[model samples]
Target: MLRETWAEIDPGRIVDNLRAIRGTLPAGVKLMAVVKANGYGHGDLEAAEAARQAGADYLAVAFLEEALRLRAGGVTLPILILTPIRPDQAELAASQELTLTVTDAAWFRELRKGRPAPAPGGRKLRVHVKADTGLGRIGFRTEAEWDALVPWLAAPDIDVDGFYTHFATAGQADTAYLERQACRFAELMERCKASGIAVRHYHCAGSAAALRFPGLALDMVRIGAAMYGYYPPQLTPPVQLKPALSLHSTLMQVKRVRRGEYLGYDNAYRSDADEWIGTVPIGYADGWSQRMRGADVLVRGRRAQVVGKISMDQLMIRLPGPCAPGDRVTLIGRQGGERITFAELAVHIDGAAQEISTALTDRVHRICANEKEVQCPWSSPYFQPHRREATVI
Candidate 1:
């Protein structure tokens, strides 16, 4: 039998985060759960369903494929594609009734190609206006660009439902720059209001805004990390939200290492004392970053140091106690009344620099935690937790 080295997705913890987020939202504001990066590297199906059930008004993903997977999995709630959809996928976007981002009029014209003149059934496709703001990403850079597309947005086929921009530094404490950016955004929104934009929602904040600057929440918020139980660098984490994903693996071996003995590639680490050297089955291929070489993990309620370079299939860790194989290693999540988070891991790699999910891959399996700890669903329902909402995929 293959040893289970998988991710445990805790839906109940996600539910708790949503409830806390809802409490923080204003009276008329709604939460748009960001399920992008495959729910921030936690499985999408589980994250989306949990967020939807916990009262999120909508779910947001990065692209058409991500949204499609959710729809195919029978997710019923509204999904917003935060990124621009490819021209070829516009019809698919139209068919699924997904809200898409329009950065320019060229993409808009492409969406009109195979689409009916009046739009089939006279139903409108939800559309959101994307402004570059300060992120300098894929969005209309100027008011002139938005002005050129105003008329087409009024067309019967497109429903210009919202206007949004990304926050570049709202996560920082005393974000004066973001404050000034928000003022500028206010001016732009005023201009849109003067020009009769008729936007259904106006938002400029994302995960950072959801936690750090609540006043900027506006009509709604697009959140990801915080919903996954992490806050910005500046904000204090509340007690209500708990991390939903925990990565655990069994210790493969524990052997005594002599002083001056080399470990791993290039003798990256040498044991200073005649102590226990342990191996964890997970490695860089499993998203245990190379920078996490000196990182810490909880083994048997005590912190164990990751020594040497992480290989594709294995990694060496230094143990402080008389440890044995089959003991659990906590990579991301709480253990022994203590918690370790992905954000902390990211800090070890690059503080406030790298996107944590970018390093994670889909190779690892996702199994429900607690319910069936004895069995992993590599070939069973523990892995096939598909909920149906749409009759046809």
Candidate 2:
């Protein structure tokens, strides 16, 4: 039988998380669920549809390709690209009705120069102006730059709709820098007013800001991590967002190691005594980290410590005798009464969650929580006509 490993996404959990987000925010604050990076390692199309159905007003992605994937998947709701898109991709962005992020006048000019025609039903290419303020990464550095971009953004061809900024320290207890960044954003908004730009939607709060400062919630709040059931260490979760991912792998085999037996590359871990070893068919290739060699994974509702090195395609674990081949190992999400967290994995792996997402290989099979078998968006219609017929809406 084909086995599944690593992340498995729960579309039902996505719906529940969106409900939690809706409950936390005030009636006026629109929720923009960030579904980028493949919905933070969860599948994107399902995540987007679930989020939209759960009352999310918008979706936020990191790149144009991701946005395009969602669009191609029949997601008709609004999606905002977080990163500055290359001007070369503007036509596809326009045709697909994906929102573009313009950080400066030059960036706006580049995108607005040769955009595609308005889609049949969708509006012209809509864009949101991002203010760098104090984030120091993307967006206009000063109020003047924002002011200069207003007139062009408000042009007839460009559907300039909103203004947003990022917060560097919104989750901290201090809230001092967040306040300063908010102030700077406010000043820039004022400058846009002076330039006669009609701002349709004004936002600056992210997930942290939405939880930390209720008053700062503007027309929209960009929620990324909170949608994944993770809030900052200090800040409380705005709502009861359950994590939407679970990773599982079956034990490939079992072995008994005598005392002083060494395991794995470089002989990283040695057996202290006669130990029952369980080998899981997962590794760093499946998003498990080598740094997590000593981390506990749930097997048969019991904790088993991972032994020695995490090989490219497999990992050895120390189980308490009873674990055998075909035993399920839970990595991300709950097993029995215990919960394994990505944050915990990050600490053990000496890597960030974003890095973990990028490092995941293609071995992990995605099992949708709702068991959706929707046709792949990337599949061509010519090939589709020859396949078996089934129940499809």
Candidate 3:
């Protein structure tokens, strides 16, 4: 990569994570690998390929555009779009054989009016019914809403592929809310069965729920964050998953500063004593925002505190001692015995680990750890330097 800062993605690690999660699942439980938000910023295509290699039964994205991109990348696994699409976009999604998430009966009415033409082989538009047991986000909330949607789902042109819900407190210390939601979903499933709607799959557990409560893996389990090693350990997950992404950079410039002197913009930091300061070529523009000012990074296996206001393209760190200009810097990974985790960084910003991983922008190039084995599918000039030409998002 041309940039001094880069993120390394290990496809093998993802594969291992998937396998570990799979080991905890019961037989005949399908695994749907969620690659939404660019695989939580680990690179969607790479994650999907890794999932496929590990025998994932299906793939899921948040929008139609994401599913279409995966199809263009030659991913043939059945892809389900988790978020509902515009009624007008139904045809395009159907044309690509993409499954869509349907929440409201009104949406189905709109879709039926602008009906997508039948496929060449009599293929029906596949759909998953989203039920809101809790979280109060999107989905049919009551039995009345489900009843209203039943007739529309019976249409000859559509297929009810799955029925699912999301748990808001799956990762929380309290399981009371999660149990209530699960019970509510169970009631809906029984109602669905009695309705004879012929729903093919039933799922409720996401990564945390699936790992913490295997019984929730009804017909399938949707593994997303945990597949990339981002789940909370407080859940005491049955399987162990390693992070597939790590960030690294080099110390571009290092200099000695006096205690009275200030560093960075607006004199954001003043050295308490004569200290060695090092500059790293990564800042907010690279997804390392100003809130990271007080964070610590690994410099030659030693912890160096970020001592100044992070700029758009660079950040300064208080070195443990005098360090060379070209010394390696570990931002979110292991160096000697020290390691910086996304969870640790997220704690500094009062957020989740996902916020840290997904915040990394495309400006920070990703170097695949095992490029030869699990080739990156992003089509960008930056990856052309590798043995095989590839791209990025």
lDDT against the true structure, per candidate, is: 0.75, 0.73, 0.87
- Per-residue C-alpha lDDT of model 1 across residues 282-370, encoded as one tens digit per residue: 87787766878888888887888899999998898899788988988877766767666767776787654226544566556665653
Candidate 3's residue-wise lDDT over 158-264, tens digit each?
89999999999999888999999999999999999998899889999999999889899999999999888888745566776788888888999999999889998
Q: In model 1, which regions exceed 4 Å deviation? A: 119-121, 351-354, 370-393
Q: Best by TM-score, which number?
A: 3
> Candidate 1, which ten residues in sequence have the lowest lDDT sum?
384-393
In terms of TM-score, how similar is model 2 to the real structure? 0.87
The residue-by-residue lDDT of candidate 2 on 1-393, one tens digit each, is 155464555566667766776677777888898988777776677667777777888899999888888887788888899898888787778788788888877765665566544345545668888888798988888766766776677666777778889999886789788889999888887887777766677889887788767788878888887776666544567566666566778888888889999999999999989999988888886766677788888887778889888998889888867666787788766676777776677667765544555455556765544433433332322111222222110
Error of 3 at 296 (Å): 1.0
Model 3: colliding residue pairs:
378-391, 378-392, 379-391, 379-392, 380-391
Task: Specify the poorest-scoring 10-residue window by lDDT in model 3.
Answer: 384-393
Full ranking by lDDT = 3, 1, 2
TM-score per prediction, in order, is 0.90, 0.87, 0.94
lDDT of 1 at 266: 89
Model 2, poorest ten-residue lDDT window? 384-393
